[model samples]
Target: MLAIRLDEPKQFRQIAIPEPERPGPGEALVRTHRMGVCGSDISGYLGHMPFFRYPRIPGHELGVEVLDVGPGVANVKAGDRCSIEPYMNCGTCYPCRKGNSNCCATLEVIGVMVDGGLRERFIVRADKLHPSEKLSFEQLALVETLAIGCHATDRGAPTDGDHALIIGAGPIGLATLEFTRLTGATITVMDMDQGRLDFCRETYGIERTVQFKGDGSELARLEEITGGDLYAVVTDATGNVKSMSNALNYVAPTGSLVYVGITTQEISLPHPLLHRREVSVKGSRNALPADFPRIIDLIERGVIDTDPWITHRTPIDKMIASFDSFTRRETGVIKAMIDVSGVS
Candidate 1:
């Protein structure tokens, strides 16, 4: 089996490893067809993710074909195409017991904490596969990315006619925007990159966008858009500590602020501002198990468009050579997909 591993920061090597054993009980052996490179993968590649281990096979967002299923695996059978929920949660954890397994205490995200499905084939728990008959491999690979936004909007609980602001125009932020739009909220997107903001406006039909200038003019612009009232739901997908900290300023009184992006640095929130607004602060981790099926259904029904999401792709043979370009801002890579099945 051919695989690409991150030997160290900014270094990837192609290697041949033994093929995985047959699926064990409650698991399924699946051939990887497509894999999406997430921001976390870029962070890991740049040595920015503290939890990321070197010499890792990095891939979590996967579209796969079930090759074989072990005993008791009823969710999917051979030849079924599916999207994988890569958060390997320990069912016994406190959060898992509470039905919040996305943030389970001992959660091991595929590709980050463990070797992931960057190779031709891998074994995943049968329960983690969300089978879809109507989606293509690329769309199936996108389920996990969309699920992140799906879960974030759920956390913020935006409603129809409410004002929601997504602070970031990256893939995660765009995902959040998709779900927030479904809520019937008047959504506004803020980003430093004009190119991304333009894409959101042209592609998503979003009319309200504030381009950050770092001069504090955006605050006035947001206030003007909201008629002096800030947004009812504000989701920050920047994963930058500065942006996360400043997100509180955009939330309306009694509104919710959801941090969909993770930051290693400590985020300082003003106690006075928090007390004044009585804002509800939330940390949205990985998507819930249910999110996969929901996103799949939405995409299947044409509710959420996946056409404009993928901006770059590379076959397995060229992925190592192309990976660096995906991280460069100049390339404008929104969602980069890897064709894992193309490996000879």
Candidate 2:
């Protein structure tokens, strides 16, 4: 079997590995069909993600076809096409016991903590497979990325008529914007990248967008757009420490702020700002078990559009050569899909 591995920071190599063992009880042997390159994967490639390990098989966003299933696995059978929920949580953990397994104390996210589905075949717990008959492999591969936004919007809890501001127009930020639209709230997107802001305006029909200039003029523009009231819910997906810290400035007095991006640096919050606004602060981690099915259903029903999402594609054999360009901002890659099966 062929697999791509991150040998070290900024170094990717193609290697041959043994094919995966047959599925064990409660598991399924799946052939990787499609893989989505994520922002976290880029962070790992550049050695920016604190939790990322080197010499790792870096892919978690997957669409796969079941080759076989072990005894007692009923969720899927051979030939089923599915989207994988790659968070491998410890079911006995406190968070898992509380039905919040996305943040399990001993959570091991595939592709980050362990080898993932970058290879041709891998074994995943049967329960992690969300089978879909109506979706293509490309659409199925995007379920997990959209799930991050779904879960983050759940945390923000935006309501109808509320003004929601999403910072960053990257994949995660755009995902959050998609789910936030369902809340019936007026959305305003902010980003330093004009191309991304234009994408939101043209693709999503979003009229309100602020080009973030760290020069304080962007704040004035946001204030003017909101009539000085600011946003009811603010979600920051930039993962930049400075942006995360400044996000509180854009929230309305009684509104909430959600941090969808993770960083290793400690974020400092001004006491006066937090105390005066009485704001609710939250950190959204990975998606819940229920998110996968919900996202699949949405995609299947045509409620979530996957057409504009994938801007780039590369075959698995050429992925090693093309991976570096995906990291460059000049590439303008909204989503890059690795065609693992060669059929797509």
Candidate 3:
């Protein structure tokens, strides 16, 4: 089997390893079909992710087909095409017992803690697979990424007719824009990248786009867009400590702020201002099982368009060179897909 393995920062090699053994009693052998390169993958490549380990395959957003199902695997079987939920949780933990498996005390994320699907084949627990309903491998691979946005929206609890401000126009930010639109809230997006802001306007029907100047004017620009009330809800997907820390400045007095992106260092906040305004701040992690189907239905109903997000495609054989380019944000990339099945 050929897999993408990272031995160190700025180093990735395509190597052939022995094929994986048959699935265990509660596992299934999945043939990788479509894989999406996420921002975390880029961070891992640059040695920013704390959970990343060397000599590991770095892919979690996967769409797969079951090649063989082990004993006791009743929910899915051979020939079933499904989306892989890569989080492996220990059921005995407090959060897991409370049905919040994303915060499990002992969590092993595939492609991060273990081998993942930047390969020809990978094995995962049977329970993590979600059956697909005619979704293309490329579209299904995006379920995990979009689910993060869905989870963020759940945290913010945007009300109908409210104004929402999302900072950063990356893939995750764009996903948040699409899902929050369901609440019928007017949206204003801010990003340093004009190309991404343009994308938000053209593809997602978002007309309020602002170029972030890293100055104090960001708040005023957002206020003007929201008709002087500021945003009723603010979500930061920038993954920058500065942006995340400054998010409270733009949120309305009683508004909610959700941090969907993660960083390694401790973040500072204006405690006095936050307390005075009675603002709520929350953190959003990975998605739960409840989010996957809704994202799929959104895709199926054409509420979210995948064509614009998918700006680059590469076959499995040319992965190394393509991966290098994709990491650089060449051509101001939005999303890049890997054709693990050797077709795109």
Q: Would you list the C-alpha lDDT of every candidate in the order shown?
A: 0.93, 0.93, 0.86
Residue 10 miss distance in model 3 (angstroms): 1.2
lDDT of 1 at 321: 90
Pairs of colliding residues, candidate 1: none
Q: On residues 1-344, what C-alpha lDDT tens digit does candidate 1 reach at each position?
A: 89999989999999899998999999999999999999899999998887798789999989999999999999899999999999999999789999999989989999999999899988999999999999999999999999999999999999999999999989899999999999999999999999999999899999999998988999999999999999999999998999998989989999999998888899999989999999999989889998998899899999998999999989999998999999887899999999999877
Residue 276's lDDT within candidate 1 is: 99
Clashing pairs in 2: none
Estimated TM-score for each candidate: 0.98, 0.98, 0.96
- Model 2 accuracy (lDDT, Cα): 0.93
What candidate 3 gets wrong by more than 4 Å, as runs, is: none
What TM-score does structure 3 among the candidates reach?
Answer: 0.96
TM-score of candidate 2 to 2 decimals = 0.98
Candidate 3 lowest-lDDT run of ten: 322-331
lDDT of 2 by residue, 134-155 (tens): 8999999999999999999999
Clashes of each: 0, 0, 0
lDDT score for candidate 1 against the true structure: 0.93
Worst 10 residues of 1 by lDDT: 46-55
